[model samples]
Target: MKTCLVVDDSGVVRKVARRILEDLSFSVREAADGQAALVCCEEFMPDGILLDWNMPVMEGLEFLLELRKRDGGDVPRVIFCTTNNDIEHIAKAIASGANEYIMKPFDSDILREKLEEVGLIEKVDP
Candidate 1:
């Protein structure tokens, strides 16, 4: 099964994302912040990442920049899952190497769609 890392400060958000990713057949892991996430990645790179924009220890944007600098970091399909819906933040995320973006309060369908759009999962008919 493919693996995914869900990075968020909120336990509730992480739990919800874990459920969605599990339903999609992904082996999911959780990190409370970007610092922890980086450590996870160093140990083993996941196939994808569901990253939140804001968090303690390190923000998503900074983490993204650092991740991209690491060898093989470019391979993981990164999806920025956050409440920031502004064009500027979206543009920054895309430019920083995120494969896709999903707003907060997402359900399984929305998560699946973003995963599919990133080519991490196959497109399925509704």
Candidate 2:
């Protein structure tokens, strides 16, 4: 199973996202902030990351920059999940290597669509 790391400061958000990803058959891990997320990444590299923008210790953008600066096998695909909907912020996320952006209060269908768009979700033969 593919692994997904969820990075958010909100317990509720983390719980909901974890449920969603887990139900979709992805192994999920979580962290409360960017700092903790980095530690999780180092320990068990995930195939994708759902990251929040405003986090304690280090923000998502800063974390992305730091990851980009490193040389590794394969940089995990990242989806920015946040309340920040400004076009400039969206542009900045893309510029910083985010594969996709999902606003807060995300709908499950939209999240599923994003996973499919990134080739993370595939149709299963019955």
lDDT of 2 by residue, 34-123 (tens): 889888887887888899999989899888777666664146888999999999999999998889999999977778878877778885
Candidate 2 runs further than 4 Å off = 123-126
Weakest lDDT window of 10 consecutive positions for candidate 1: 109-118
lDDT of each: 0.95, 0.87
Provide the RMSD of all predictions against the true structure, rounded to 1 decimal.
0.6, 2.0
Q: Residue 68 deviation, candidate 2, in Å?
A: 2.2
Determine which window of 10 residues in candidate 2 has minimal summed lDDT: 66-75
Q: After superposition, how far is residue 1 of candidate 1 from its true place, in Å?
A: 0.7
- What lDDT is reached at residue 41 by model 1? 98
Candidate 1 per-residue lDDT over residues 1-126, each given as its tens digit? 999999999999999999889989999999999999999999999999999999999999999999999999998999999999999999999999999998988999889989989999999997
**What ranges in model 1 sit over 4 Å off?**
none
Q: Which candidate gets the maximum lDDT versus the true structure?
A: 1
Hey, what RMSD does candidate 2 come out at? 2.0
